[model samples]
Target chain A: MFDLEAVSAQWLGFTTEKMTAKYPVEHEPIRRHCQMVGNTNPLYLEPGYVEKTPCPPTAIPIFALPGRLPPDPKPRTTVLDIGLPVMGQGFTNMSREQEYLKPVYVGDHLAMQMRIVKLYQKPTRLDPDSLWIVTEDLITNQDDELVCLVRNTLLNFRTDEEWSATGVTKP
Target chain B: MSRQRYWEMVEVGEGMPEYQLEVTPTLIADQVSGSQDYNLMHHDRAFAQSQGAPDMYLNTGFIEAMLCRLVTDWMGDSGTLKKLGIQMRRFNTFGDKLTIKGKVTHKEMNAGEHLVYCDVWVESDREGVTVPGKATISLPSNQLNH
Candidate 1:
């Protein structure tokens, strides 16, 4: 029994208060991130090579997530905060859109705020009662300047239903 | 930062050099750790299986990073990623080899900013097109730098 109305009512217009990162952006994490992604772009690696340390704008989406720092983490909201009453084992990434408005540099403190944009109950061939959720995140710097805007869509559905619908044996 | 791909040099409908990457568990773990996603789907195979996923797949952040690399590597350090949009159609499971391809679709100057639009997609060996995306990059002009 999926309660579409109740779930939608709970998350609609739900936005979190701005939460600031514990520390300013550093070069070490950025370097490690670049290395892990196999990104050799000198712009993100070498500090003195460029006029300023340009944090990979793409990386900001990850950095914008909450709980990056534990042990008394700041109260930040995320798309995961929405708890649906559906019987789903997990959710999957559906899509994402990011708009970089301003450049983020090293030593800048980033603050993130997320909001639930909308939710749709669309059944898919793989699963019945597929719920699609859209979230919008605003990333700002210490100066309160908008750095980036990230909109993400996620799909949540019952694994058993998907298996049954596709007639595939569950692994 | 020194290298530059000038806006004038980019032509509409020009294909970029394809980038190939082999998907590995180590890479997936690295992405999870780097992004701090801590999502079970990205790490725990059992959890992913329980979710009806064939295997633990890459996270959204990782895919976005790959798309960013594809564009940055092509447009050089001077290029700026103004916007990026991606639609995930299939899961990029482990052991899949990915080929990232992109082409310049449009170019124009907007309010003194030289913007180049591109169509980008990642083709997975297991799944044809796992992620299709578009990017808006601002490239430096030779005149501006010189």
Candidate 2:
């Protein structure tokens, strides 16, 4: 049950070749994302309020997406699921758009690249057969500028008896 | 010391001034450990009811940082938020109470900034607009020579 035009003709225009951010913009993960969004907003908890803006353009969409931690734990893929092939387990997150051209201070160093601009396979009340994926993520820093631009809109699904009980086929 | 919002005193159906929060679980595990997105349906409510979700929810960078702290607490600290847009129809689970609303819906001035265009939302007293959004702020115009 997986042949949405040969998986969008091999991922429409697939892309994912730049991902750099081993560590740079710091300050306790932007104070743990403004204290888990309780956001005191003194331009992100006043580090002198606004003198060189210490960080808080809504912390640039959580450091422009970067996180994965678990000893040998790989199940939750992203970076637009590196090389898509849809085995659709189930996932959801319908939209997001962020643009913020510049503002991400502390130490800098951020980079990302991902693209698979769109794909829609209809029906979704949580998946009567859904598969709407749209990704963008352009974020850059460490002097290259281009601060942020995240587009994300994901929905992947699985049910046709979880796709024929994953007997897997269609490549 | 917040209080700036200028863009010539923004008006076009003005509203902005309604934000609330109360959905907890340590604010969803501090947004799943501050956005590392350990996605177990955002902290496993039995893995979000085994993916049929009836529990554990709220993550998309914590609803995009609570819709960027409800438009940066209503465009104050010299407003800039450039742009933000959201859509997730419903599912905010866990104690629910989120509020957050906005208005202004129009105002422009390109290249030189002074933007301001909103239409945010994120209701939840059980479900009303569980995240519907749009934003673009720049505001800071009192003719500072541009």
Best by lDDT: 1
Candidate 1 lDDT, B11-82, residue by residue in tens:
999998888887787888687666667767777777777777888888877888888888888898778999
Q: What is the C-alpha RMSD of each candidate to the true structure, in Å?
A: 3.8, 17.6
For residues A1-171, could you state the per-residue lDDT of candidate 2 as single tens digits? Answer: 577788788887787877776677777677788778777766555565434564666566556455553222333757335858763777778887878888788778788888888887888765665778888878888777888888888888763456456685412
Q: lDDT per residue, candidate 1, A66-171, as tens digits?
A: 5765422222225545544553655787899999999887877899988888888887754656888788889999889999999988887777655677686654
For model 1, state the Cα shift of residue B79 in Å: 1.4
Candidate 2 per-residue lDDT, tens place, B12-120, comes to 8898888788878888878877777777777778777666678888887777777777777777777778888888888898898888888997998997777988898
Q: Compared to the true structure, candidate 1 yields what TM-score?
A: 0.89
lDDT of 1 at B91: 84
**Residue B37, model 1: Cα distance from true site in angstroms:** 1.6
What are the candidates' individual DockQ scores?
0.52, 0.23
lDDT of 2 at B125: 86
The Cα RMSD of model 2 versus the native structure comes to 17.6
Interface RMSD of each: 4.3, 10.4
Worst 10 residues of 1 chain A by lDDT: A69-78
